[model samples]
Each structure stands twice: as C-alpha cells, then as structure tokens.
Target chain A: MIFKIAWRNIWRSKLRSFTVMGSVIIGVWSLSFMLAFFAGFIEAYVSSAIENDLSHIQLHHPDFKKDKEVQYRLKDIEAIEKQVTSLDAVKAYTVRSLNNGMLATATGSRGVQIRGVLPEKEAAITNLDQKITTGVYFDATQKRNPILVSKRLAEKLNLSLKSKVVLTFQQANGALTSAAFKIIGLYQTGNAIFENLNVYIRQEDLSRLMGETAMIHELALLLNKKDAIEATQHYLSQHNDSTQVLVENYQQISPDVNLYESQMSVATYIMIVIIMLALIFGIINTMLMAVLERTRELGMLMAVGMNRSKVFLMIILETILLGVIAAPIGLVLGFLTNAYFGSYGIDLSSYSEGMEKFGLSDVVYTHMQTADYLLIMIAVAITAILGALYPAFKAIRLKPVEAIRKI
Target chain B: MKEVIKVQAIKKTYNAESIPVHALRGVDLSIQQGEFTALVGPSGSGKTTLLNIIGGLDAATEGSVLIDQQNISQLTDSQLIDFRKEHIGFVFQAYNLIPVLTAKENVEFVMLLQGKSQAERDARVKDLLGAVGLSEQIDRRPNQLSGGQQQRVAVARALASKPKFVLADEPTANLDSKSTADLLDIMAKLNREENITFLFSTHDQRVIDRAQRIVTLEDGAIISDEQNAIGS
Candidate 1:
C-alpha cells in the first residue's frame, strides 16, 4: 500500500516526474557512449602498437637490448626457433637481425633501425603485405637486396619504389660496411613514429653483409589469443636460460602501452563518477521539490499513523523507481547507438595526422565489456538512493501537528 | 457510562520565550462515552487548542490528558503516533482525505496502517462508507468528489479504526447548509446506533444545536458547560 501511494504520488505531477526521468535517461546514455568511445580509442592505440612495433612477446640476447652491437646475437637460435614452433599458442614468429644504422639517399640521409626479416614470416605476423599502398611485397620483385621502407620514411629520404638507398652499419667483426639496397615496397602502418624510425630488408642479405651466415638478434612472436601471452612468456622463460635470453611480453617492451591499458579502468570509473555526481544533484533537486509541494499531504499521512521510517521509505522508493524505470531504456538506447557506431565505425580521418603521432587509428569502433554496462547500472541505482537521502530526511523531519495546519 | 476523555487543567502557551500568547489556560474538561459534545467559542477562545490537546496532536505545557485511562502526555512522539492511530480519529474543516487515493482507499488507509488483513479492511471500508452514505462514490478520488462528499469520505476514514472518539474542527465550515445537515444527520445516527463518542470544536450554531452538551470558552477559559434537551 505504501508502494501504491508512492507510485500514484509520482504521477500526480507528470511533468516533474518525466523531467527527472529524462535527465536520468540522458545521463546514462551519454555516459555509456562516452565510456565505449574511450575504450575503442585505447583499444586502437594498444592494438596498433602491438601490430606495428611490439608483437605479443619478444626474445633477444640479454645484452642486445642495452647495446645494439651485432656481436651480441642469439646464443642458440635454432633451439629457440624449435621451441617457438612447438608451442600451440604461437600463431606466428619472426626472427630478425636488427642493426642501428644510417640510410643515405642521393637527396638526403637519415638515421634508421634496419630490421633484417624473412619476408613471408614477417608478413604472416604483422600483415605487412596488406599495408603496402603503392608497391608490391618482396615476393613480387626479382631484384637482389630488395627493401621495404615506410611511406613516411621514403618521403623523408626523398626516395620512392625502385629507388636505391645505401645502408651503412657495423658487422660481427667490428668492420663498418655499407650495402646498396633497392626499395621493393612502400607501406603505411598509421604509426608515424614507427614508420619514421624503422626499415625492413631480407634476413639473407643482412646476414651475408654482416659477415655471418645466421645472425639472429631478435625473435618476435604473435599469439593466437592475448590471454595466452602471459603463460607462453612464462613457459619460454622457464625453458630458456634467463642470463642469455631475455624473454619479455609486449607490456614490458613498451611501458607507455602498459600505462594506457592500466589507466583505462581508472579512467572509466572516473568518468562514471563524474557523470553520476551531476545526475545526483538533479535528482535531489526534483525530489526536494516534490517533497516540499506535498507538505500538507505528507503531514496528513504522518497524522494518520504513518511512521517516520515508512514515510522515508516511500520517498526513497519513489526516487528509485524513477531510475529503475529509466535506466534500462537508456541502456538499450546506448547499446543501439554503440552497436551502430561499432559496425560502421566513427570516422576521424580529418584528425588522422594528429592521431597517428600518438599511434592511434583514424576509424575507431566503439566497444565496452558487458561488465561495464552492469557496473553503470549499479552506479545509477546508487546515485538515485544517494539523491533521495536528503529529501527523505526532510520528509521525516516534518512535525505532523504543524504540517497539518500548514496551508 | 464510562468516561472516554479526561483533560486536567491543560495549559498551552505559544512562543513562551518571546511574547507569550496563551492558547489554552489551565482548562479542564471531561466527556463520557457516546457523548455528542461541542467545544464552542469565537476566535482566540482556545476551543481548537483544547481540542488539539485532547486529540494528542499538541502537548500541554502543564497538564496531562488521559484518554480511556492512558496518560498520552507521557508517551514518546512515536508512541503518541501509535496511540493516536489506535485511539483517535480526526476530521478537519478542509476535509484532509489523501488526494491521490480514491474514496474507498482513503477509508482503507488507516486500517492498512493498523496491519489489518485485506478481507478485514474491505469489510470495514464497505460498512463505514455505507454508514457515511458514500457507498456510490467509493471509487472516486477526492478531487472527483464534491466538497460535501469529500467531507463524508473523511468521516468514513476517521471512523475506520473504531477510535474511542472522533475530533472534528469546523468540519461544516466549508460545506453548504444541506451538506452540513446531511453530515450532522450521519453523525447523529452513528452516535445513536453505535454509541461512538464525538468531540467537535466549532462556531456554528447548527453543530451547537445538534450537540447533547456544549462547552463554550472565552479568553482561553470555559465560561459555560450546558446540556441541551432538544439534542438529548
């Protein structure tokens, strides 16, 4: 019966009730969309970093990370490659002979990290073949000493497809060697920083030029499932000698990615709290007006044997019912909005140049976990209850004798 | 006959700290069961104040009120609410039926507070609304009913808990003469049939004419208490 009275009381002022509900609906919908958009933004950034620069895990000669000397090559390259192939979690793996060197074109010269990679293996892991916009992959060219340079780097060095560039670097024997290589492919990964710093050439050409037959400086692995990364890293770490081979996950390789990933949860909670705080004030204002306007009726209720607790409960119930009725509608609307944007994606091509500097993709697909949706609903319920407290307290504070006499 | 209410020299002063205005000054009164009594006075004569004191709606500054042998002045605020719920019913001049509820629900409201079962509440609501001659308007909300009909609903709601007595303050003030007469006829029939005691604070001669006993006050003190042969 208390519930019935409360329900009817809310409808007594239909406009007021709708106004409060409308605010709640808008708050929930906007909050959900904002969270999903941010999640998509972060997802694009982290995934781009992984795909372009850091695979799920990387293995290097322990000293090669601190100093990029060609002498600090893998101790047992064949054994590591065998172990990598045996793991069911490994989707693709590439061995690279990395050298920090200078690439000189006739027009200009720039510092670059020359990555010696097996074309088919590297393509399988990074999908480098699909990213080629103007030139074909290495398999299509019959030229010797073929190279792949990022479109950004090619432009910076005033070189294009079929252009010859000279790469000068240190050999295993401490001799500085320079080789002329022809660029067979130009690719754009939408990561301006990575594109500007690194260039890829065949492992055979790099090894032969470095005065060694098989010089493996880095081994990168991509996993079928991200959840398998930790276990695979642990398994490789257990099998290998830690002193010789340093096995590191993507997060350990790039601390900035880790920071962004860790801060995602905190950022989501902060956004929700900020939005709910605004909604709490709105709900409190509306409920206070409702309570104040019904002063005489509330007094009559108290005089007719309705206790303070029941009166308090009635007001609380009314406030909560408003949220409960509006939250699901907002959730559905938010879901539909997200689903629509997730399918088509939100185009940010106009900001692509600025976004690429931060390693984020231009088109972002909205994404949120099911758990986050549930958490948002719980947040709104708590906001409504918190919003009801002051008004409910004011209601229970009324002196029945005086309230009854109030006009 | 059993004495249903006993007021012992009750005094009520408004704003005692700054400019003391005495609404009730050491007034004492008693009424037995089944008595149709009116506390009559002009403005500022303490009739409503005395009725409020008797109804446990206001506390006296210096005296105690015993209703059916329980000293209500000693009860806590929460206990007083429970006490009033069980023992007192009130009808105000403006007809304070809950506006959101239908006429039948307003009468059933008190019984709901009493934790009465649905069957019990339904039976009593039917009987009481019928007793008030509002059986046909049971489904209508207070706003849908006439002023007279709303007052009748308030009367039915007041008697829903079967209180020791009903306190009515100017119940006929907003009603037409025909509505007032119809309301008085209903109260008189209830008084005669069920022996329910009634106490009223009023300035209307029609109510004074219908009361078996009239207590008139002047300057916060009672000047006369008389029994009328016409009402008896």
Candidate 2:
C-alpha cells in the first residue's frame, strides 16, 4: 500500500517527475558514452603501440637492454626460436638485429634505429607490409640492399622511393662500418615518434654489413589471444634461461602503455562518481520540492497514524522508482548508441594530427566490459538512495501540528 | 455510556519564548461513547487548539489528555503517533483525503497503516464507504468528488480504523447547506448505529445545531458546556 501511494504520488506532479527522470536518463547515457569513449581512446593508443612497436612478448640478450651495442646480440638463436614456436599461444614471431646508427642523405643527417628484420617474418608479426604508402616492402628483385623508411622519415631526409641513403654504425668487432642502401618503400604508422626514429632493412644485408651471419638481438612474438599473454609470458619465462635472455610482456616493456591501461579503470570509476554526484543533487532537489509542496498532506498522513519511518520510506521509494524507471531507458539508449558507434566508429579525423602525436588512431570504436555496465547500474541505485536521505529526513522532521496548519 | 475522551485542565500557549498567545486556558472536557459533540467559538477562541490537543496532534502547555484512560501528554512524539493511530481518527475542514487515492483507497489507507489484512481492509472499506452513501463513487479520486461527497469520504476514512473517537476540525465548513445536512445525517446515523464517538471544532451554526453536546469557548476559555435534548 505504501508502494501504491508512493507510485501514485510521484505522478501527482507529472512535469516535475519527468524533469527528474530526464536528468537521470541524460546523465546515465552521457556517462556510459564518455566511459566507452575513453576506453576506446586508450584501446586505440595501446593497440597501436603493441601492433607497430611492441609485440605481445619480447626476448632479448639481457645485456641488450642495458646497451644497444652490436656485441650484445642473442646467443643460441635456434634454441630460443624452437621454444617460442612450440607454444600454441604464439600466433607469429620475428627476430630482429637492432643497431643505433646515423642515416645521411644529400640534404641532411639524423640519428635512427636501424632494425634488421626477416622481411616476411617481420611482415607477418607486425603487418609491416600493409603500412606501405609507396613502393614495395623489401622486394627481393632489387639488386642493391633494400630498406624501408617511414614516410615522415623520408620527408625529413628529403628522399623518396629508390633513393640511396648511407647507414653508419659499429660492427661486432667495434669497427665503424658504413653501408649504402636504397629506400624500397615508405611506411606510415599512427605513432609520429616511432615513425621519426626507426627504419627497417633485410636481415641478410644488415648481418653481412655487420661482419656476422646471424646477428639476432631481439625476438618478438605476437599472441593469438590477448588473454593468453600473461600465461604465455609466464611459461616462456619459466622455460628460458633468465640470465642470458630477458623475457618481457608488452606492458613490462612499455611502462606508459601499462600506466594508460591501469588508469582507464580509475578514470571510468571517477566518471561514474562525478555523474552520480550530479544526479544525487538533481534527485535531492526534486524530492525536496515534492516534500515541501506536500507539507499538509504529509502532516495529515502523520496525524492519521503513519509513522515517521514509513513516511521516510515512502519518499525514498519514490526517488528510487524514478531511478529504476529511468536508468534502464538510459542504459538501453547508451547500449544502442555504443553498438552503433562501436561498429561504425566515431571519426576523430578533425583531431587526427593531435591524436597521432599521442599514438592514437583517428577512428575510435567504443567498447566497455559487461562488468562496467553492472557497476554503473549499481552506482545509480546508490545515488538514488543517497539523494533521498536529506529530503526524507526533512519529511520526517515535520511536526504534524505545524505542518497541518501550514497555509 | 463509557467515557472515550477526558481532557483535564489542558492549556496551550503559542510563541511562549517571545510574546505568548494563549490558545487554550486550562480547559476541562470529556466525551462519552456514542456522543456527537461540538467545540464551538469565533476565531482565536482556541476551539481548534483544544481539538488539536485532544487529538494528540499537539502537546499541552500545561495539564494532560487521556484518551481511553491513556495519558497521551506523557507519551513521546513517536509513541503519541502510534497511540493516535490506534485510538484516534481525524477529519479536516478541507476534506483532507489523499488526492492521489480513489474514494475506496482513501478509506482503506488508515486500515493499511494498521497492517490490517487485505480481506479485512476490503470488507471495512466497502462497509464504511457504503455507510457514508459513497458506494457508487468507490473508484473516483478526491478531485472528481464534490465538496459534500469528499467530506463524506473523509468521514468514512476517519472511521475506517474504528478509533475510540473522531476529531473533526470544521468538517462541514466548506460544504453547502444540503451537503452539510447530508454529512451531519451520516455522522448522526453512525453515532446511533455503531456507537462511534465524534468531536468537532466549528463556528458553523448548522454543525453546532446538530451536536448533542456543545462546548463553547471564548478567549481560550470554555464559556459554556451544555447538553441539548433537541439534538440527537
């Protein structure tokens, strides 16, 4: 009966009730959308980092991390490759010979990290062949040594496809060696910093120039399932000789990526708290007005033997009913909006330059965990209950004698 | 007849900390079971204040009120509410039925507060609404009913809980002569048939004329208390 009265009482002022519901609906919808947008933004940035630079896992000679010298190249490459290929979780793997060198063209010279990679293996792991905006990816038919420079790097060097560039670096014997390579292709990744610093070349050409046959410094592995990353890293870490080879996951390799990923949950919770706080105030204002306007009726109720607790409960029930009705509508609207945007994506092309500088993609597809949705629903329910307290307290505090006489 | 209400030397002063305005001055009154009584006076005569005190809606500045021999003045605010719920019924001048509720729901509300079973509430609502000649308007909300009909519903609601007595503050003040007469007739019939006690605070001669006992007040003091053989 209290429920019946409370339900009917909210409808007494239909406009006011709808106003409160509208605010709740809008708050929930915007909060959900904002959280998903942030998640998508972070997902785009982290995935770009992983896909273009850091694979799911990496293995390197332990000393290579301390110094990028050519002498720190991996020992027993065949044995390491055997262990990596045995894991079903590894979808693809590649080995690279890394060197810090200076690339010089007719116009200028700049520092660059020359990555010597097996063309097909590197292409399989990082999808490197697809990033080519011009020319071919490490063509075998080219007579001279072939190299891939980023489009940004090509512009900075004032060079284009088939242009001759000189790479100078230290050999395994600490001898200064210089090699001339023709740029076969120009690739563009979302990361401006990465594009500016790194260039790729064939492993055989690089190993031959470095005065060694198999000069593998780093082994990168891409996993089929993201959820399997930790377990795969654990298995590899347990199997490998840690003192010789350092095994690290993408997060362990890139601290900023890990930081961004962890902050996503914190940012999501902060968004929910901020939105729910606004809703609490909205609900408090509406319920307070409802209580104030019904002073005489509340007095009459108390005078007729309705207890203070029952009166308080009725006001709370009314507020909760408003949330209960509006939250699902908002959730559905949010879900549909996310579904549409998730599939089609929200194009941030207008801000692409700024986003790309931070390694983020222009088009972001919204994504949220099922747990986040449930958390938001619980947050709104708690907000409703919190919003009802002050108004309910005001209601229960009314002396029936004075309230009844209130004109 | 057994006494249903006993008010002994009850006094009420408003704004006591500043300029005190005494609304009730040591008034003593009692109503027997099955009696129809009126507390009558002009404005500021303290009739409503006296009725408020007797109804447990307000505390006395001095003295005590015993409803069915329970000293309500000694009861805490929360206890007073429970005591009122079990022992008292009120009908306000504005026909204070819950506007959101239908005629039947208005009468059934008090019974619900009492935690009466649905079958018990339904039976009593039907009986009481029928008694007040509102059987046909059972589904109509308060706004849909006329002033007379609304007051009749109020009367039915006041008796829904079967209180020891009913306190009405000008129940007929807003009604036409015909509605007033119809309301008085229903009250008189309930009093005679079911032995329900009624106390009213009013300035209306019609209500004063129908009371079996009239307690008139002036300047917060009872000036006259008399029983009229002419009224039943």
- Candidate of highest DockQ: 2
Work out candidate 1's RMSD over C-alphas: 1.5
Candidate 2 lDDT, A1-407, residue by residue in tens: 89999999889999999999999899889988898889989998888998999999999988888888888877889998999889999999999999999999989999999999998999998999999999998767767688899998898778999899999998878898998998988999888989999999888988899898899999999999999999988887888788888999999899999999999989988889899999999999999999999999999999999999999999999999999999999988888889899999999999998988888889999987778789889999999999999999999999998898886
| Tens digits of lDDT, candidate 2, B28-95 | 98889989998888999998898889988988999999888888899999998888888898999988
Give a tens-digit lDDT track for model 1, residues B1-232.
9999999988899999999999988888999999999889999999888887888888899899999888999988889889889989999888988888999999999999999999999999999999999889999999999999999999999999999999999999999999999999999999999998999988889988999999999988889999988883
Q: Give the residue spans of candidate 1 off by over 4 A.
A: none
List model 1 lDDT by residue over A1-407, tens digit each: 89999899889899999999999999999989998999999999999988988999999988888888888888898999999999999999999999999999998899999999898999988998899988888784565799889999988788889999999999989999999998888999999999999998888989999999789999999999999999999999999999899999999999999999999999999999999999999999999999998888888888878888999999999999999999998999899999998899999999999999989999999998899899999999999999999999999999877888888
Tell me the TM-score that candidate 1 gets on chain A alone. 0.97
| Per-prediction backbone clash count | 0, 0
| Model 1: residue A200 alpha-carbon error in angstroms | 1.1
